[model samples]
Target: MAGATPLRVLIGKVGLDGHDRGVKLIARALRDAGIEVIYTGLHQTPEQIVASAIQEDVRAIGLSIHSAAHKTLFPRVLELLKAQGAEDIVVFGGGIIPDEDIPILHAQGVRRIFTPGTPMQEIVDFVKGLGQ
Candidate 1:
């Protein structure tokens, strides 16, 4: 396993959501856990996010949504991934998402949703499990 590549992930903030403190924290946590993280900063479109994921060759994409755009944005990313033949990249998110929206998001192919107060270790473990 010495030559094995570490799990790489793309941490993105899509739309006009300017609140990136949480995303930055998660990025740091993932890095601390030894996962490679490509922080895409804020104000990314679904196109930009998917392009980055493909370009970076990441195994997963983590979106930080606070602008109530998950319904629209998450699916667009998924669609783009499929269109680009990158559908195997797992998509997950965390932020101000309501409980009622979780099921809808999952149905749209979002692998998981972590709301406020979810532990950082939980996120780290979830990403780590993706390789298995």
Candidate 2:
């Protein structure tokens, strides 16, 4: 592991949503899978998320939103990332998002959206596959 580079991911909770249980689970799971996870805690703004992603130089961002703000917040994060020239950083998320909104989020540059009951290994494999 000395010379090999591990894939890094930023796990964030944006907007006013305070429920962090799921995000914490993901952070731990990703860490256990050998991915470096930078958890930004709760109530993070889109700007703050992008800034941290830029600073951490992560390969991806996994946001957990349960406040139904994904429609607005996710796109804002993507826009800010693009404006900051960090567009290459993959943006994905998981939460109580409705199925109808997934396509819009994808169009806004969110690479993936995992709903409740998604297997942990699937999330792990998704991020790992990004390296390939």
Candidate 3:
């Protein structure tokens, strides 16, 4: 993990969802944790997000999805990463998601899902623990 830069994170708001409160919070939390965080604002396409992640060379990609596009968006992001040979980058998601959808996401190669009320500390710990 040399030159890790304290675990960089790309926090993005994907799809047509204009709501970005959650992602903003995550970005601030990551920044406060001394990790480099890039906030991609709102209404980002999957391609834009992946491209940003690759450019930033972030260790993880955090998708803040409050819309009903996780099932579609999540897998698409994975596909984009695979296509670009960036499949090793850790994928994380936050915001509202059904309980039944968690396993499917993990099976689809998403490593972490942070639901509502997930503390900033937990998110920080989760990302840090991933490097272990």
- Candidate 2, residues 1-132: lDDT per residue as tens digits? 243787889999999989999999999999999988999999999999999999998999999999999999999999999899889999999999999999989888899999999988899999888776
Top candidate by lDDT: 1
What is the lDDT for 116 in model 3? 93
| lDDT tens digits by residue: candidate 3, 24-105 | 8888988998888889988899999999999998888999888888999999999999999999899999878998999999
lDDT (Cα, tens digit) per residue for candidate 1, span 26-132: 99999999999999998999999999999999999999999998899999999999999999999999999999999999998999999999999999999999876
Q: What's the lDDT for residue 11 in model 1?
A: 96
**Roughly what TM-score does model 3 have, to 2 decimal places?**
0.95
Q: Rank the candidates by TM-score, best first.
A: 1, 2, 3
| Clashes within 3 Å, all models in order | 0, 0, 0
Winner on lDDT (2 vs 3) = 2
Which has the higher TM-score value, candidate number 1 or candidate number 2? 1
What's the residue-level lDDT of 64 in candidate 3?
Answer: 86
Q: What's each prediction's TM-score?
A: 0.97, 0.96, 0.95
TM-score (C-alpha, index-matched) for candidate 2: 0.96
Candidate 3 stretches greater than 4 Å from native: none
When summed lDDT is taken over every stretch of 10 residues in candidate 1, the lowest stretch is 1-10
